[model samples]
Target: MKNYFLLLICMILLSCKKENKKNFDESIAAKLYNKAKVFRNSNVSDSAFIYYNLAKNAYLERKDSLGVGKSLVNMAILQHNKQDYYGSIETSLEANNFLRKIDDSTTRSTLASSFNNMGICSSYLYEFENSILFYNQALKYVNIPSNKYLYYNNLGDVLITLGKYPEAQKNLSIALQTKDSLKYATFINNMARAKYYENPNYNPLPEFYKALKIRQDNNDLQGQNSSYATLSIYFFDKDKIKALDYAKKMLEVAVKNNSKEDQLQALQKIINLDKENYLENFKKFQALNDSIQIARSKAKNQFAVVRYDVEKIQREKAEKEIEGLQKNFGIGILLIILIGGLFLYRKRKKRLEQEKELEVKNTQLKMSKKVHDVVANGIYQVMTKIENQEHFNKDEALDELEFVYEKSRDISYEKTDNQGEEKDFSEKISETVSSFKNDEVNTYLAGNDSGTWKHLSTKNKEEVYQIIRELLVNMKKHSKATIVSFRFERENDLIRIFYTDNGIGISGDVIYKNGLSSTVSRIETINGEIIFDTKIEKGLKITISFPAS
Candidate 1:
């Protein structure tokens, strides 16, 4: 193949013969960027990742923060596509350093996007805390509030998932606050949901009407369908015929959207409300469910192909380079043989390097699953127990739960050695606190000196993370705090976390009697101290201090 790069260099030099200039080699990198964009649209995630890897390398070589940040965004998406939720969080965190270097508004958008996807990953894994954390983080970077409608909606969804009806409604309300009719319609649909779930007396007919009217006007097929389903549910208790009509409309929309979940849910309602119509919809529901399952697998396969293709291109490019250099060097027969040997050596060296890279990637993949599935999973399980008011001689379950989250935190943060500057630790904290925000409560993380935080070992760092996470969880359940601030402070030889909130604070007497309970033990394990600063109407502030050095 002709080297367009060389031709371009020749042209630039020829055109500017009057003055000498240092030419930049951006051809290979530009190709990577172009290919990645193509693969991303094609939905070939793995191939997309390979292309993104190339782009990342090219941009880094050129010291382009924008390019690097974009590549990281693509990498994170690929990780999510591959079901490596924990891996996506880790990669996004690594992407953060490069992102923080960029001054452009686009970088902010990129960060928001990264956080949005991270939230999805965490949510699917049932790590509600991490999911909410990422959602809140995304909210901050959405420069255009109009672009934040979906984010706020999603935030409300997670809040509902946590069984915090009031909190969910609050978030959904904000989602509609812009007064964009289309957005407001969506929120009404969501609010209908919140009321239904959290309050027995909640009636959604009026809200559902508001949603239906807006969705119908806007031609929002999905939203219209959703409103219909809610209406069906709302009328189910009163009028059977009315419920069936609404249910039929919902089913039609579900079919149009090709949404299995919605279809199944709609059909299930129809069957329950009108058992006489079951025989008809049941067949369609089963078929649709099967079809969507196959679609999911097919999508996964397509993503894998893209990954393979990207690798093939890079290998082909390297082989061509080595072969061309060897054949073009016709200075002497002896030189040709020497050059061929050098080429083979280079090829072998590259192969070894690839092996090392693959090993590192696999290790990361393992750690990610462990962190998300094992540790985050355990946290959710314990949280579920607490939320449902389940039996709590819970010492056995609590002990098992704490063990997993702490261990995952320990292993997942091996590189930082528990340093304050650790991005993973910061992210981990965000993930933990994120789940606690709801109608009645909100969690906010503030004042981290990421640029200045430097000391702490990986173990110590994770220990700090676990301690803070446990404390925050406790505050959310017990503090009755409407507003909570997760503040991180570092001084010479001392690291401190001040979890202050406008909630009911516990007295020091309670702490002495119930100190180091559950998660607090993990904090004590790391030689940490906790103090309660509570006051009337001011809420509660628990200051936790630990050794940074």
Candidate 2:
């Protein structure tokens, strides 16, 4: 009786385990689908596609037809967004096949969406009859008012393309009656387009303004710019001043949005409108248009390469599985041995040379920063002091010093000519600080010239000089500082420097530029650390420490 109980308990546990796993997989698939929808609504097309694929694969493993169908339709929409019309059609058909096999009332909406996407994709490819068929099928399954109106709009667009004006107008009129304000502008614009096609000489200015007002009020930048371009073209042959005004507005919108394609289109129209300067404007327009085309081509190629890499990874995984089953180990092993030897041989030689070159380049850049901070700021301050003088003497020694300092800035990879000379470390810091001090700010130094400066290396001294000089220059340019303090301390063989300024402190998001960046690198090169306390309101505080050399 104990043995029978044990067998029955094992069977029950096994069944429960499978049930739990199925529930887990179903939940994960549902979550992924929901997340994909969110991303889709936010216009994150690539991310939406990725999550949809993940959900589809999970649903396929669980044999969940409804989940798989929904994922496929979402992916199809993403493909449509990417302008992959054929791929969109294929994905939508696959989704429809899955949805059709499952006879569930809840799946009707998903089926409707899939068929609607198929219709849109087909229409984009100019397959009007196929588009109409898909639209009709979507209408049969669509239960919601919003989707029903969308189908009507899509059908109207295809009918307009097919030159069936009466049918297009009828469908568009029906779509306009739906109280969905989000789509109101688009429907209005489509009706205007149909009207334009119906009558060649019709002025669609009122219709264009009606759509533009809605789009602008909603802050729909792309829609607003599109309306500007349409109005510009509509007025191009009728009223030159109005055409130029709209074209200029379109250009402004396009530039603001960084839409190079629309900018190119607007520029072309502007050149046509401004006939007096046609040649000049046309040249500029052509150059920008060509550049935009090249950039777009490069982006398309990059996307293709990314897709190829993903496909390659999937192919390699399948190949690995096949090889594992076959146990085809000899060829791979031989190739690995040969490739490994060649790789190591090339890698060692190249890496050593590259490392040497990088080290030299870094040193040059560090020296450049030091020169810019120390010599450049000192000379600029002296020039400012001289310029602010009530009495001027051109023959003074200070003028010669200024000239020499200006000349020193031209060198390629060395600190200022006087930088390496042995001088009192604290005195040098004081001099650098005083250069940035004007009537607006008072500078003070403490413990800088004390015995703690004695244990520092020449390199350390130079780096310290550069770092302090950079801080002063930054304070002068940005800080609006009233008072500055410099404090030096020694603790356990660590030379610590503290700097503070009563300036408008940096915000949390300020990025360090070349001067501060190089200071950090220089300190790190000498095995030191620096920290900033910009969170302090209305003041900047910094602490830097390096071991005494």
Candidate 3:
């Protein structure tokens, strides 16, 4: 009985120690995180990163996911400020993974923040589509007014980059409605930029000045630098003096903040706008930019090494967890392997079946094209000849119809090769034009004797033959004309075909329906160009150009 009582006392003591350690670690992590936030706000990125990482390690040791996620958020922002965009994205995504595992209002807000960081990083990397996607995702979970300001402002900026000015303006306006001074400055500045891009002649200077004034009053150094930078760019082509003034101000602010990147940008603008001092400024800008780039590269490498160390630690932890799972369930592991193999085999079989089906569909599409060009065109020509003839022969009609029917039935049939068979390719083109000749239209052909036809491949010639034949058929059926002309010429490496008709042209803009749309698709397939012109008073004019090869 005494031994049992002693054992219970021992367990109680251990539990108390564990609880005390948890409370102590939590307090230390919270203090570290608060210090990191202060450092981050001051733009002391290196100090912020050190405290954030320290807090992150403490949180990890205590198994506090929320603390870890918050620390990662600060770390990611530090990396982003350092211009380590790829590393920022990685850290933000890791934060998101942790924050998402705990479903709560606070965690959801943290996840939204992670997504916002991801959007900013993506925008910096020029992945506009992914940036927009991440911004929208952030917006979806952003319930806080402060977070809304961020989401809407960022969304507007990205939309501006995408050239969706109206949408950008709308989003920026929404962000402004939140009535936050800092947000107001940012949104107005972005709105000014959007308006400037929407119309070059429109003056966005008033809005720019408003944002600048607000930022200056708030003592926002970063915002002031941004305003100066934008103002310099805004006045660059309009007023050189104002541009140089703003550039100088930007340089002043950047130097005060010790922001080398901003200094480089300001110097570049000054060099561009200050024509009198351009040569001197150019040398200064070149020297400063080179030095900054080297420093930045070194800093980026250091940050990347830190991130790699963090990743390695996480990977080690993951491997340990996986090892535990493997040891705990040997039979389950064997079953999983068998199931995975079966799943892969089935997936492969399904993919092969899909591929086979796609092949068949593609073949059918090709066959349909053949039928439209060969059988359908043949029938249309025969009908036109019959309509124009004084008398129609029944045997000739039957023979033509039977030939088309047979061609339609043969699924394995190949298109008749016209290579070497047509001793004169131009003669074949001339014959195609003559087939459309009627009593009402006087058809003419020019440049048909050019040796340009020899330069085109057999496939190209066949496509040309079909295209010209289709055009002629359309003219015959729809064009009520007195004259039609076909002219083919070669300019260097391009074959140009110009067709003009004296027919009563259709009214207004030409609407390409079935036949013309198909013609366009065929021309596009051969990487050709086609232009059509039709008016009430003028007859239709069509020009086609394609490479000889």
Candidate 4:
């Protein structure tokens, strides 16, 4: 009886001690988290990160995996908010692993959230294939009918970025069906935004008006601001003064939200609609963008600091730890700064180079369109007329031929710059066939009324155009084709370019002569597959299908 009483006293003392410890850790963690919030609210990212690091350490030392995961998720958000995409990816990946190990349903949304974020970052990096993969992964976790809206919206955005328009439209329509307020705003904004580039019917102006009404009623300042920004672009076509007025309204809300990122983003997009005060506007844009980016970076660093502090507090409680932890942190900070500085510098340089290239490409595209409409097609008409006229005198024909030859040579020389880099495929085909086609050939086009080049990339456009030209030349020289029909259409991810002609078909025993050998070589070089459809009187229909990218 005496021994039992002593043992009970010891147990009571230990229990009381543990209770005190738990209370202490919880108090400190919560306080640190709140302080981090205060710092973030004040636009002091560095201090916020310091506090967040402390909270992360506190949760970690307590062996609270759920808390740790949540803390990490917040940190990941901060990192992404700062544009530290690689670091954000790593943080999310780690958090996702923890979430996967946990079976609780309460925080299961973390997995889908992480995947959606990863997909967005991947799209920013232009890794379209991987972006699609991550978006699809998000769908697995967000399959619950109630939770499907945001995931499908995110997936649709990624698909659109991947140039998978049909798939994107399907996903976006489903996302809208859920009518989730935030997701609805986002999906509607994105869908309407696509009208500016890809779709012709739904102008961004009407969609923005509708979205703005909903957002204003809900008091969603961010959505209202974004819609206004988009509206600014839309109305520049009709009312410039109204567009600028709306754009200013957008910047005001972003400022009120205390979201520097949004403020800068809104300002940048809105400036595109501005016509006057160009220099002043550009200076303001650069300064504001830089300041906001710096603030976000500081906030991200603060989150990192908070996590570190929590870890240190825990280590000190458990078996005595070495005191060199802070010293090592100093060294690590310097190294990371140096490395990050170098990475940012290189990334900036690369972006500048890409912008320059894009500018040149846009110029080339404009020139090519002009040439196709004015010069190339005009020459093709002249050639066709000449072939039909059947002129009697050789001398008169020689003068006309000389004029065409000199003009065509000039165009050819201009196109040969950068090894045909500037030539549009349709223009090239028009030029090449005019040079080779006989008078009486009749051409039928199926599905070519889409004005011919809506969906083609410059490279594919050039290649496919060449393919058509080469086939026409081959038929005229050897196959004796009078009538030809060309077809081009898209299905799934593939594009099929096919042509049929009432011409002599090839025998397997005979070696490909004239332009046939060159056509086969070109197709092979492009890694495109060719199917021959030729039977006795059936003539020839060659179809080629290849991956778009």
Q: State every prediction's TM-score relative to the real structure.
A: 0.52, 0.49, 0.53, 0.49
For 138-180, candidate 3 gives per-residue lDDT tens digits of 9988879988987999999988866678999999888888678
lDDT of 2 by residue, 1-549 (tens): 134533432332233223477887778678768877897899876656656776777688789899889888888877776656677788889998999987766699999999999998876554568999999999999988888888899899788766677899899998898786658787888788788767877766678889999988988878878788778767765788998999989888888887776787787677657866644564565456435433433333333333333333334344445445445555777667655865685577568557755765565455545555554555446556555875643223233332333333223212243444344566566656655543246677787654777667787788888788767766765787878889989877888889999988886567375137777888898799999887787788999999987
Off by over 4 Å in 4: 1-64, 124-128, 143-147, 194-198, 236-242, 269-273, 319-549
**Tens-digit lDDT track of model 4 for 1-549:** 134523432342223234478877777667767776887789665556555655666666677666666666766766776666667778888878777777665557767777877877776544557878887887777646656777787777766554456777788887888656765777887776644446546556666677788898899988887787777766655787888888788889988887666666556545455645533554565455435433433444444444543443343343122223434566777766655865686588668657755765565565455445444454455546545776543333323433333343433234431223323444444444444422235565565433445555556665666677667756765676767777777676676788788877676555264446767777776678887765556578788887654
The C-alpha local distance difference test score for the whole of candidate 2 amounts to: 0.69
Error at 197, model 2, angstroms = 3.9
Worst 10 residues of 3 by lDDT: 9-18
Question: What's model 1's lDDT at 170?
Answer: 89
RMSD of 1: 11.9
Quote the positional error of residue 63 for candidate 4 in Å: 4.2
Cα lDDT for residue 400, candidate 2: 36
When sorted by lDDT, best at the front, the candidate numbers are: 3, 2, 1, 4
* Residue 134 displacement in candidate 3 (angstroms): 1.2
lDDT of 2 at 177: 82
- Candidate 1 has its poorest 10 consecutive residues by lDDT at 13-22
Runs in model 3 with CA error above 4 Å? 1-19, 41-43, 307-549
Error of 1 at 380 (Å): 34
